[model samples]
Target: MKEEHMAKDKPASGIPPGSWPVPLGLPLYVTVEQAAKLAGIGRDRMYEYVNSRADPIPQMRVGRAKTLIRTSAIPDYLRRRETA
Candidate 1:
């Protein structure tokens, strides 16, 4: 399904699947795809980083339907990579 259409059917949380978790003015949490876009990475690579136990990026999941990554956490992950 197209990413935009992913949210056509609202989940139990009442929030759309692909929509941003935070309000318009605030940019705290974003969907993994959005995070990937911001970080200049592919969605698959972002998911791999999040799923990798060795150095997984922080994430929030809702019933396996929604997954969100903190925008702030991205920098921390990159910093760890730089140091290591």
Candidate 2:
């Protein structure tokens, strides 16, 4: 049997050297301020939306102290506004 030699620098599946894995879920790291900017709303308005029972709500509370928003949700939020 021939021995298989794998390159040390390449990923196990042979994905190209410079390629990154596609993100599986939404990118969720924006601050409330950043989310507000992306939503084209004021920070206080974002707080209102977070407090309301609205669909397409982008903000999520992680643990007790950390709050985050998925970047992918911004477009949905904007579209919701347009249809409202």
Q: Runs in model 1 with CA error above 4 Å?
A: 1-26
TM-score per prediction, in order, is 0.62, 0.56
lDDT of each: 0.80, 0.68
Off by over 4 Å in 2: 1-27
Best by lDDT: 1
TM-score of decoy 1: 0.62
> What is the alpha-carbon lDDT for the whole of candidate 1?
0.80
Worst 10 residues of 2 by lDDT: 18-27
Model 1, 1-84: lDDT tens digits are 675575666665676655764446647888989999978889998989888989889888967689888887887786776753
RMSD of each: 11.8, 5.8
